[model samples]
Target: MNKNTFLGITGLISCFFFSGIALLQAQSKSADLKNWPKGSSPKEIGTRVADHFVVTPHTNFGKPTPPKVITYPESCTWYGALTFAKASGNKKLTRDLAERFEPLFGVESKMIPVPDHVDYCVFGAVPLELYLQTNDKKYLDLGISIAEKQWGPPEGPRVKEESHEFYKQGYTWQTRLWIDDMYMITALQAQAFRATGNQKYIDRAAKEMVFYLDQLQKPNGLFYHAPDVPFYWGRGDGWMAAGMTELLSSMPKNNPNRERIMKGYTDMMASLLKYQGKNGMWNQLIDDPEAWAETSATGMFTFAMITGVKKGWLDKEIYGKAARNGWLGLVSYINENSEVTEVCEGTNKKNDRQYYLDRKRNTGDLHGQAPILWCATALLR
Candidate 1:
């Protein structure tokens, strides 16, 4: 109990505390430096992605089965390739892909028709961006023309009964808003608005997106695949994942809807993280554990989570691990051909668990590929 002994002990404890703080700070700095690449840039990673898109005629067109001309999933591939081309500053790749769509626009098939205005909305944005980068008015004109079709009063005659059904559904009507619409159209519309300085496109995109958000969100922050359905589909969530990222990237930082959308995104991520399979993928039916772990949804979630963390929209320490896990799971499914397999094809069920489970795999559809490319691109960043 001497004063000298007490002072010596206090000095030793203070040194230990300061040293511990210094050690922790040093570790954090090392971790940050470790994540930083020494040579590669986002643009370089983008070029690698573009190089992966070496499509053969057979791969792109698929084997013909009688009257049905089964084609590779074109939309997702187009988007992924276009994204890579834009990122890498590859004008020829961008132009070639942009021109290839002319045939799609001229075709009349139900599966991949020219007048499928919804898809035109999704794929057109890349062409528009390409035009912006290259000063090619042709791409810009085509993109704007196709985009305008999605807006304004009905321009063309109704081809199918479902078309009218979608119109009547009013956002949940057969074609109103669904999980896929976010990815397929709304993001492109937002980009179109930004590129063209047209408030109409932005307003339309926001209104439709908000309507979809309002209709699909559950009390717990999870969204159903479709408004009329009780099910939450994997690619459906993927659509929202990519859609939100794309939309957020294009939206002005000060826009009023930005905060609401970000909250929705964060809430969705929070709900999603709890359900990630030990294997790192989400199930075909997200809320159901019995369903198989799926790649498309997991890739989209990975991309969204990582992008959110890097942009400071989400806590990197918490969501970053989840994102990394999902990315690893997704990468496990990639084949040597660079084709993404086991993507659940499009589903329409609102109540059937078996339908979700029984969906075919390894088809390498655009639905799967787009999200995978997106996840890879984000990870590379």
Candidate 2:
């Protein structure tokens, strides 16, 4: 063969070989997600989630569109990013992200009286996180303010057990016992207890878990989404599972309610073991076989189960495999841009099963990405 032809053939062969390797790498990254090195590291995955908002700074996916105001899911994602940053030892990254929500921290009405809705109270822990790291009085005051509000009145109209009704039927912030409330309020109170060394905050969170467990936990060990909603919504259970783990992490080991909380958490984990799909994912309707596999719930469950195994709350020999598989399942939904896909949009309690089945799934939604970040951080922990 001619010299030029020989050289051309050699170059073509090299290009194909390199291209094939790249393709395999990409495939392996997506496929072998449970494994590290060949797969993405937790920090790497979390950084992508953080960078998505960091670069954009104003995601239209949010209600007020970021930098202007923080919303529930956005705040959740931000806190997860902060946690991951702290865990990964990226001090500057943590501080920079925490500052983005500083303005929201100082607003009195937002933190006081519990803001009338638990959703608004979701980000209360962010200020506490910043306060813990920086020890700035402003963040500390903000956290305390939020905690005080959430603790409700000293002796006024408190949400009682009788008020636990579905569909917001006279359900006050304290009384409404949706599964989402676990994450929204419990995590904040847990952080409050941790930040302040206050037993009241811990008691409030643990007691609420006791109340909800009585009201909602089924014989199957899973929780109903709400009183009126019988279906086990994936994210709702995710909230319950993740919230309990967060509370368990901070709750005093000697507290009276500790064993009760632990049982609820472990029982929930047992239920989750039965529902995990063959692909390492859970469905939108967790008990439903036909429902599509969901990414956000998968991430939340992964975080919860892994936390359980690590803390010895769950059997590592059994749940460790599930956690690993769950992580592998979740990473598949995270695309090349670090955008998490198949995340169920923000949902409300519905009496019908199809309502949940019909919920739209979106990419890069904070509801989806936050869990991924949280799961990544948990894996590291």
For model 2, the superposed segments whose C-alpha errors exceed 4 Å read 1-37, 58-69, 103-114, 154-173
lDDT of 1 by residue, 1-381 (tens): 799999999999999999977854443333131143422233443454455653423133333442232232455566666666655557787767656654544562333434345644565666676666666777677767756666533445543555665455443122455677777666567767766887666655665677667778777677787666778887787778777887776677777677777777888888997898766689888988788878778878887887888788888777877776666566667666666678787566567678788987755555676676565556555
**Best-fitting candidate, scored by lDDT:** 2
Clashing pairs in 1: 169-173, 171-177, 342-362
Q: What lDDT score is found at residue 31 in candidate 1? A: 17
Off by over 4 Å in 1: 1-49, 58-73, 88-113, 157-175
Poorest stretch of ten by lDDT in candidate 1: 31-40
Q: On a 0 to 100 scale, what is the lDDT of residue 65 in model 1?
A: 43
* TM-score of each prediction: 0.76, 0.83
What's the CA RMSD for each of the models?
A: 9.7, 6.0
Backbone clash count, each prediction separately: 3, 0
